[model samples]
Each structure stands twice: as C-alpha cells, then as structure tokens.
Target: METSERIAQRLRQFGELEATTSPLYRRLAPLAAARPELVALLRERRSGQPPANVLLAALQRRLMARPEAPLRGYFATLGGTRAPDDELATAFDAFWPGELDALAGLVRTRRVATNEVRRAAVLRLAYVAVARRLVERERPPTAHLVEIGASAGLLLAWDRFAYRYGSAGFGDPDAPVTLTTTWRGTVPPDPHAPFTVAERLGVDVEPVDLDDPEAAAWLRALIWPEHVERAAAFDAAGAVVRRLGVTVRAADALTFLPGGLDALPGGLPAVVVHAFTVNQFSDAMRRAFDQALGEAARTRPIYRVGLEWAPGGARLELTTYPGGRTTLLARADPHGAWVEPLEDEPATTSR
Candidate 1:
C-alpha cells in the first residue's frame, strides 16, 4: 500500500473503532479528516513501518497520568464524569498545530508502541463460556492455563474478575472489578459452572510490568481518553495483578508456546488461551504454531480457546488436542461486552 493510503487506513480504522467504543474519539474524528498533515506526520514519522497509531502511541502518552507531562491535569479533568462534549471538542479544536506537532515529534523519536491493552480481563466472559462447555465435555479436574501475547499477564488473572451477563454471574462475588454485558443470542452459559486453574503462565514479545510505574502508565495510556471506565478497569486489574504477584515472561509466542505446552505435566487438562493475539503472526508463523500444538496434543490433551476477528464477527473458538478438532462456540464483541453463543453447536471443526 502507498504511504498515504496506509495513513488513511489507520485513521479510518481508529475512527471506526472510536465510533463504537468512544464518544470522545468520535467527536475528534473531524480533526483527523480535516488535517491531512496529521496523516502525513504519522506516515513520514515511521518511514518503513505500519502507520503509527498516533492517538494511542503519541497523544495519549503525553496525556497519560504521568508526573512529567503538563497536560496530565487536563487529562484528569476530561477523564472524569463531568467531561462534556463541548469541552472535549474545544480541547481538540484548540490543540491544532502546536500540540499536534509535539505529538508528531514523539511519534518520530519516542518509540511509542501500539496498545497492548491486555484487555483479557473482560475476555473472562468468553473464558466462562468455554469453561462451561469444557465441564460438560470432559470436566477436567484441573486446568493448567497458558496465555500467548499475554501482556502484563492480566488476562491470566481472569479468574479474579467478577462478571455478570444477564442473570448469570461468575468469579469472585466480592471481586473488585465487575464486567457486565447483556446477552446477545442463545441462553447465556452457566456462569456457576465449576472449573479449576492449577497454574497460570503467560508470554509476550515485550511484556509490561505492572509493578513498574512507567510501564503501568503506558498500559493506562493505551485506553482511549473517552473510555474512562476502561482506564479505571486497567488500574483495578493492575492492582489485582500486583496483589496476586502475577508475572509474564518476555518471549515471542512462536518460540514460547511449544515449550510452554511441552512442559505441562501429563494427565492434567491443559488449555491455551489467546485473545486478539495470534492474528498478529504471519501466515507461516501461525501455521508453525498450529503444527506445534498438534505435536503436543499427541502427548496430552490441550484445549485452545481463542477470540479472534472473522469476516462476520469476533469469534470464540475452541480446539482440542490429538485430532485438534475446533468448535465455533460463540461470536463476541472484541472487548467481551457481549457474547452470542451458537444456537446449534457445530461439529468438531478446524480452521
């Protein structure tokens, strides 16, 4: 794709994402449409790479709750419930050439990474859906959980978050954070179904450390300013991670998964979970990872639960070891805000 097209592509993508997920970002969409210079700066800033997600990578970084940024106070006010649409529009309209120029400079020099929001916390909703199916199928005595692309290992701690979907509820009733989403179709899964997690391990190419203030700040910045609830959830999840002493190793998924699966003790049920992660891998790498999973399945059962984008919707899929049969379990919102279970479960399938 040409540089201009790539720039326009990212802008449109983020704009669309904001249209659904964030009112503040939706309000600011005109700025992107009106200013071609923003696209040029992002395109030219990173010469040979996919266009930088300047909104998350650069602008949010400066506005993040960091002591050094003078704009932190501004961010705090806007992040609050009192934040009005007019004020938000004014903020963007006023930022213009000055703030935008600085943001462009940051994109050029600061090495801003894409959002690894590690939003697996909410994905627990999907996990619960799969877990109930697992209980019905095999009822594994215990599950050894492994997560790929588990930045900060937050999702590995899904068991810690409370969830309420319609009348169903799961996890700790007294959990600090609660995720509630309405059911879309089919009866909701039994949230009270029993499952055990024996161990949790996670791998990421560059894992964030919740304990490190700077690293934690970056994770917070990944949340769009308009999504105040998500920002609060990140903080709540981080605190839980620290309190629980969760740790994720810095390793690429391609190299980590095979070994991670190989080391799992035999006889115990093993499950690998990845939410919006494997899609980042190249076609060859994805095939190689699948091949490795197949090899491991020959030795022991490994249930793979994945939430990924499809042409129709975000799909929740399950794959069992040995034959590596997969099932389309549900279609969910990317953030797990809603899950619509398949009315008639498909036969064992593979993608």
Candidate 2:
C-alpha cells in the first residue's frame, strides 16, 4: 500500500499537469490530497491503476447515480453550470462521506480504461502513412487492424468516423462521429490516401460489454467532468460500434498476439495498434510482448502503431517488422487533442 504522503504528492502532481485541461480536477485534486479521508480512499486502488483517476472516477460515478445531488451541479458532464471554485472543495468533502462504501467499491473494482474515441485521429493518420508506404513497396493497402486493450472497440471503427485535422478532412463525410484535432509540425500523409480496414479485432483481459448499462456507465464516469465534448463523442461512437457489432475478445496480450497474428487472412499484412495500453504491462510482460511480435514477424510482415507515454511525453510510434524499423511519427496528446509530427529521420533497430 502507498503512503498518504506519497498519494498526496501524486494528487498534487496530477492537479498541476491537468491545470490547463481540466480546471475542476486541477482545483479539487490538491484539496482532496489535503484531506486524509480522500487520500485513504485512493489508497485502495488496484495495482496498475492511477490513484487520482480512480478517486475522481469514483466521485463522478456517485454523482452520475444521484442526478439530483448538489454535487452534480459542479460537474459539466452532469449538466453542472458552476465553474471550479474554492466552494467546490467544500462540496466534494460533503459529497464523498455519504457515498463512502459505493466509492470504495468503485475504486477497488474499476480500472482507468478510458476508450477515448478521439484517438482515432492519431490512428487514422498513422494508418494512412503505413498504407502509403506499403503501396510504395508493392504491398497491398488493405490490412487487418488488431487493437490491444481495446475497450468497447470504439477505435476499431476509426474508418467509420469523419476527421478534421486543421483544414484537412478525412473519412466518411456522412459519418455519425466526427473528431477534430489540432495538427502541428511537418505535413502528415495525404488524407485522401487509400487504406482499407479488412477487419477489426480487439484483445483485452476483461472486455467491456457496452450492452450492459452498468459497464457503459463506468466508462462514462471515467471521462473528466470538464470534457462534455468527450462524453458526447463517446456516446456517438458507442452507437456506431453497436450498430456495426464490433467484437473484443477477452484475452491477455502476450497469450493472444502470436495466434492472433497467425490467424489473420493470408496475403494482407497485420496492422497491430495500441494506445495507452502497454504502460499497464509489467517489465517482463512488455519484453515478452515484444518477443512475441518479433517471433510473429519472422513468418510475415507486421506493422505496429503505438500511442504511448515515454519519459518525456506521449509519442506516436510506427514499428515495422521483418527489418524492425521504428519511426518516431509524432508527439501526441494522451487524449488525442493534438499531434506534433517529428521532423527527424526514422530510427532503425534490430529485432
């Protein structure tokens, strides 16, 4: 178990980092950290889960359940018009104690599996780049997209949504869900490039069943109270996913990758993708996953696109197998708000 002082430090750091993006969390996190009660609640979080996010989600879930609760008025997602203020901390303190048991249950069970559909913006750009390269090398532009830790498979439907990157538009113009992202640095691949998703498959340890209201509600609760747009996009994407009937198989990444890659239809390459997923892996598991991919590549080509956090910040990386070349595509927002492409040459590594 983590010490209260350590947990408090994490909360303070989280507040500082989110100061610009989520004003509500920024103000409340530091205040929550000072209260030993709130710190104790966060201490119960499962391993690999972010304590701050877990605490916030638990509080949000309680507010979601009680529509008429006074605390709901403070959350933008819950139709709250009030902005974050000093009184917000007082409101949170009063709200948490009454719902202590429920909040504790939530923090203990839930993982921060926020399936941000906006990430499709980053994935779409990488897919087009990969497709263009494949076409250049005389390979087919079609691919089977397999996502690791794909919650609800919303991102698997990347091609189903329209995107506006700065002035450039991509995907179906008539699509239900449209995502707009800020583009920075060198030009990305042609938005008009041809790339087909032959099929979509997702692997996760415990796949979320959107059909379950409780399960879907947990996902909604995970969204920051300030991000009303994100909540709306999630709902829209869920509708599209349900209509398309996307499937996510419940399995571990290390156990699933080898067979999953081999099972893909022959003649076409596999575009393996993951976003904010590998950070959950233990060091041994990460190494094993890399070995699995390397072993799979010996049989056929595999293109892996990863949007993950490193020491400095989140990166958009494209790693190709057979000759294990890794390209630093861009630095990106964890939630896909923006992308800053790298101008340097691609980096190579021997697998």
Please report, in order, the local distance difference test score of every candidate based on alpha carbons. 0.65, 0.84
lDDT of 1 at 74: 41
In the range 1-351, model 1's lDDT, one tens digit per residue, is 356656766667666764565554554554565567777677646544434344444666655534444333345423444343446545654554666766776666533333323345335544555566566777654678888877777777777877777887777889987767667766656544435678778878888787878667656665666666666667777788789887688888877766677776767767788878888778999888888887777766777888887766687777777677777777776766667777435445755
Off-target runs (Cα >4 Å) in candidate 1 are 1-20, 27-41, 44-52, 65-106, 109-140, 191-194, 343-346
**Model 1: worst 10 consecutive residues (lDDT sum):** 110-119
- Most accurate candidate by lDDT: 2
Candidate 2 lDDT over residue span 1-351, tens digit each: 789899999999999985567888888888878988888888888987888888988889889888877778889988899987668867877788889899889988898888999998877768877888789889879888899999899999888899988887877889999999998856754655747888789998889989988889899999998899899999999999899889899999988978778887777788889899998789998878877888888767788888988766588888887667788877878888887777535564444
The positional error of residue 240 in candidate 2, measured at the CA in angstroms, is: 1.5
What TM-score goes with each of the models?
0.80, 0.89
Pick the TM-score winner: 2
